[model samples]
Target: MPYITGERKQGLLLPSSIEDYINPSDPVRAYDAFVDQVDITELGIQTEPNRVGAPEFDPRAMLKLLVYGYSYGVRSSRKLERATHHNLSFIWLTGGLQPDHKTIARFRRDNQAALSNILKACAHVCLKLGLVEGNTLFVDGTKVHANASMKNTWTEKRCLESLKDIDSRIARILSECEQADASEQGNPSLVKMRECLGKQGKLKEKIQGVLKDLQAGQKNATNTTDPESVRLRSNGRLGVGYNCQSVVDDKHGLIVHSDVVQASCDSNQFSLQIEKAQQALGKPCATACADAGYASTEDLKKSLDEGMDVIVPSARQVKDPSSRVKKEHFAYDAKDDCYRCPQGHLLRYIGDHKQTKSRIYAVGDPEQCRQCPLFRRCTNSDQGRRVERLFLEDVRERIEQRYLQADAQAVYRRRKLRVEHPFGHLKQNLGIRSFLLRGLAGVKAEAALAATAFNLVRITTILGPEAFVQRLAA
Candidate 1:
């Protein structure tokens, strides 16, 4: 019933190397080897041991710290800095060099592009190791809480209110200046007045800029703390956050690409992310799977036209409330370019719905529509039931059919498990539900490292620790 012998605080200790502490099977060993193999200096990270003012922490060591931290969910710079001082694996990774939090934070902030390039390099490594099969690739997105306070969130109405308040202040200031000028020519306090004007001008410009952004439909809600972060709903709760997208090969669920988008929706995210995956993997994906959120006519056109098999379920239309009749209950007539209601009424083509890029069909005879037994059930609208079919409706229909197939559903169902490998581990296991960095750029830097860390863990898991280390050396 005795614990392992403890060392005395003041006793002379035997000389020991930190490297002795890391096990051969430790994932950190593979991570160290991976960083050593990557040419980070060429990827835009400047490293020179001779720099003045402070000892430059080697870029390789810094990258290892970041990536290793992310692998276990230790993303805070301060925490990573502390890890250098006490964490055994970290001490071995850095060789006892402890860079302050500022240094750690600056490296990540300034080398985001380089860090992102490292993630691409990881994809290439996956391909090299045969982890990426170039077959079915699952693309998915999840929202992470941004490093912003809800108090800073501004709605369109809030922006307008701010603008109005600024304008009134400006008016009052200018009127006071005019009164002062009239009271005395060459006002003795003209310099102070000019300073006041300048300050007001800058204030007005900032408010106007926010107002302009709100008016331009940039985002529904913007946070002043991190202007690029948008208010989005994730896990059925509204919060200020960024959308993080990931592309994973179905074979090993290894991430091939990732990015932090400012937008809240995945509708327009597929094109850019998939293209990056192709560029990284050095080959086009044979097939791609995504959830219903990613199914947009514009994006589907691009993905399909690019020759990638896509299985994104189209957005479900609202079903008739009274009768519980779904839009699918209606039949489309290609020859007539109309829809036949389940109740046997002809809904003729009306016009193109520009917003949706779809053609509208409506029942011309409200009397006939009301006569149907499913009238109020089918549609409560007095104008009769209407349907909007996309000009590219055939593409959606094809995708819908493909998604319903036994084979396609089998592949599609794996999307959550496949893509969520990184996110679930990052969030639930690593306790990274909220980002520690603010602004889109900072969050992106964090994401690049976080993803690279994930790839490292996945790589080691697939190859085993010893082989992973040996492969990096190879």
Candidate 2:
């Protein structure tokens, strides 16, 4: 068999054009066209037709380069700068202009607000293209690693210990400096000791600041590298990262709203996400679905009050291992406002627990439970069994009832598919396991750019380059 061969130094007779490098059907062209049509001026990008001083690269070109680079999973600014020189797609997108990595990094960092607006712009485009229905939204959150390292994170106790160690080291160094100065004049050892002391002083200052924040109850743990980043449980392990929440429209998998939060859990974030999604869509979503993590009584009530049909599974109650009779086995008598146990015992309402906002109901007579034949299987406590119902127990029961319906169950089943798909693609394909930028603001910008890139790719996939270009033009 003959091996395929090519000329080592092939020369072109005619000068090759950058346009000739990529086909018109290439997605980069669509990306370029999309950027060209979108009003990035609202994103704080300059759009002057001409400049007087030293020539500046068009903001549109930079936007195109960044968006196109993110879509193809090239997130590092340095890598993108290199791509501008080597990659034909990047060359075509930037029109042969290669901005340095600092410029690229600055563009993303300084335009954090604008980057978020760009994400909204992309969502608006999706809506305009009739790709997003904005009727049903799926809310979910995933932990994305922050730029900080887990090793850099410190709890209050750890911070105090570290500060003590630094103080001891400084004391030892000061003692050494005193000895060096007394032993010899103009000794290098003295100079080295002073330098070490200065370095330690700065570190000590930083640690003390962190300690102050901890003492003030501003944060639970502090990351020296990224203060806004928090220690969160991710992928079954503790890591320094942010919890990224996203709301996806059911019409397409496009993310309508996204936010980066320090909260480790999603229970309190339900209402905020719904409000953001509704604001972004400029209309209310008829239904919302989330996993059990987002199910909280306050959030559930808020969702219902907002007129959205929420489909979130309630938290599973802890079953007593020794007893077979679960809370569900108890039957409530609405007429008498009491619960009847499986053994035919009435648990009358005693009073309300104000702290827990639950009404307590316990068996009126404990001696009757002591004499019952199923006492061991029913109540292990000497006070007999007790039941607590929340003030909003009726609302919870109504939500539970709705969750069991065929329609609600069907909608809930699509939650994982709609929500996880974007995260999976972002992590597995785009390599967004950890954020390139530091701080919450930077990470939020990075996330917005990533989401915008994902939406662009989806748009291009659904409507090929030509049609996508037409849509942008439209």
Candidate 3:
């Protein structure tokens, strides 16, 4: 068949297609819609809600935008504002209008405490949903960035130097003012110089105040922050960062409890985190696991006191080879509070309160130490041979007792599978590298948000979309 010429076969002109897809369904809208169902504002965020003021923006709306934005990795406030105007999802979520960057930034900064409370509220909701199964809780600490800096910080000596610099600058400003006065005929520069001198005086006052505070804190503090924060190095580098501690449930990898601390090491982190986790669940933890870093005699005893079966490696001792061989080679006597020498001479206790307070116990008679052939091997002190037993010796004994237990090993093996898996998911999939906020308070809030985000993912994974929607609605 040959090709036919075109003919007007169309009857009445069909109506133009009416559906023009101007705005597609937005994920931010979907997320915000989910948040809108929650009654977080009803929980009373602002302490004084009735103060007469200009028409205030809804805290809930701001909260919804922030949580949704952070969940999707849109962290910058300025960027979020732009997205509200341009992105369909953000536009839908923000109700076709964009809040200014100052408003968004103020929401985050002014409401830090309120935002923190909201996190706790979210955890309570999770508990209400029966999402937390506290069969095992793994505790660990990670370093996060702080607001202070290595450069801004000053050590004891550096602080004095800073004060001197401020004083010298103030003196120079005063000298300039004096020189200006000598040549002044209502000189404009003289007025400026006086103002400059006034500002310099204020700067000197602030520097002096900081110096006084630093000295006071250094002299009084049982634990001190080097340069404004304690001198603790992480990842083989010295920087100011907080150690964020978390105790996560193993069953669902949900964080049961979390805290922020200024401590540089994990030595004292165990008991506090474990106890908090236990308290949150309202039950005693049957078993707990930690790395060698948290292993300490005091913590082991505290864990025992809490009725928690702890699994940790033994603490290392700092001694030269000779002392190591001498004491370790011989057997320790608990009842006698002494050690038996290899030659079978009983090492007796000699009272020395000063050494004892330092956790060193004086043992063996001075005469005995003076006479023994092995004196050269053991005794380097002018006093006598001493054996320093840890105050909580039984704690170490208990740790050794648990180290041999099969259940301890089983729990420890579960630790990597439990806590690290969630941490890996958060860092890799959720994009939590460093905190968006700074300082202890800000970092704590960020940690809470990260935990909440992780839990949201987990809740979605476990409950599926439909069930999670129902749970959130409920």
Instruction: Give the best candidate by lDDT.
Output: 2
Superposed Cα deviation of residue 325, candidate 1 (Å): 2.1
Candidate 2 lDDT over 1-474, as tens digits, reads: 999899969975743788888887998888888788778888767666775778767888988888888888999999999999999889989999999999999988877777777788787788888999999999999999998888988788998898999999999998888888888769887888899999999998988888888889878888889989888898699999999999998977899888999988888788889898888878888998888898788778998998889888887532235446666788988899899988899999999999778888899899888888878777699898888878888898888888889999899888888898999999999899999899888888888888888888888888999999987787
Residue 430 miss distance in model 1 (angstroms): 0.9
Q: Please provide, for model 3 over 181-270, each residue's C-alpha lDDT reduced to its tens digit, 9 standing for 90 to 100.
A: 788858999888778778877766766666677678743221122332344586698776677777877767777777778787888789
Candidate of highest TM-score: 2
Please give the ranking of all candidate structures by lDDT, highest first, separated by commas. 2, 1, 3
lDDT tens per residue, model 1, 220-294: 777888888888888788888899999988998888888999777998778778888888888888898888888
TM-score of candidate 3 against the unseen true structure: 0.75
Q: Is 1 or 3 the stronger prediction by lDDT?
A: 1
Full-model lDDT, candidate 2:
0.86
Ten consecutive residues with minimal summed lDDT in candidate 1? 317-326
Q: What are the TM-scores, per candidate, against the unseen true structure?
A: 0.86, 0.89, 0.75
Better of 2 and 3 by lDDT: 2
